[model samples]
Target: MRYNRNEAFRFAFKEPLHARFSIYEVNGKEVETTEGEIQLMDLSPSGAKTYTELNIPYTANNSVKITIHFQLNESTYNFKGKIVWKKVWSDGFMYGVSFLVNEDMQQEIVKQLKIHVKSLKN
Candidate 1:
């Protein structure tokens, strides 16, 4: 299947899953590593939509990347990506992280996601 640069197919879990993330990059400068908990709303091989109570400011034109770590079926996974979309709220925020991964890594993620889905159905 052909991939689209502006959009990606995402998968949603039957139950809520939480993950930890830390600021990895900002305009190529080292950061203090602001870390927080994020609820996984939906996931794709290349990106994810997440919600968190911690406030993360989105900057236009500046490169910002985060390292997010989560587990599925007892295996740990991580990715570094920038926020491509955001929705601010009074108490929390929703952000989309766009990860740049190789095709092999992408396949691994898809394998893990498939296992997660099967477990939920059982």
Candidate 2:
């Protein structure tokens, strides 16, 4: 499928997530870190678009550790993500992150999102 670069998608709910990205570059020899709160806008199989206070300048394939929080089954869930995409915004940087090494957590997220989407449909 082809996508237009200037398309708008609305989010069902703005989930709050906070994470610290340990950015590595220069062949794993240089590192920098930034902490910020992200407002997850929308999610797709490709990635998620999030708004953050820290504007991290990164290229494609840059690795980052994102610590995020979500609510599932009436409990808060926290997990880390690997940065996949980064873009600059007026407020800050928007990043696309892929969840790392947590199948259960990912399941819980999917469950919550499914429940939310289902409610919207009804």
Candidate 3:
């Protein structure tokens, strides 16, 4: 089934930002955690594409119950998502993460992204 395409707008930051992520099960079981410096390549309300270097390989459609922690404006934010697509490179992997979030969380993400973008403009 084809998912609706969401326009992905890229954001540029003056300094680098890293997203620390942990992949686990929906039942709250721990799987693995890794810290990777990530570039927010593009974003939409429902999903985001990130560029990072991962030591492990993740398959497409792999239900990635992940907790992504990152700092924005000196405040830390945590988001959860599932891996919809994965591309393996010689060094690491790139993932297209579809957020497993409710309406409120979705709104929060959008708001935070907007804020982050605005901060970069200043």
Number of the top-ranking candidate, with lDDT as the measure: 1
Report the C-alpha lDDT of model 2 over 10-119, residue by residue, as the tens digit: 23345443333444443345555554456766643324567777766557654555556654335565555567787788868778766564556555556666666676
Better of 2 and 3 by TM-score: 3
lDDT of 2 at 8: 29
Cα lDDT tens digits for candidate 1, 19-96? 999987788887867578988877888888888998776767677788899987888888888998788855898888
TM-score of 2: 0.59
Alpha-carbon lDDT, every model: 0.79, 0.56, 0.63
Residue 62 shift from truth in candidate 3, angstroms: 4.2
Task: Using TM-score, give the best candidate's number.
Answer: 1
Better of 1 and 2 by lDDT: 1
Rank by TM-score, highest first: 1, 3, 2
Ranking by lDDT: 1, 3, 2
Clashes of each: 0, 0, 0
Per-candidate TM equals 0.85, 0.59, 0.69
Candidate with more favorable, higher lDDT: 2 or 3: 3
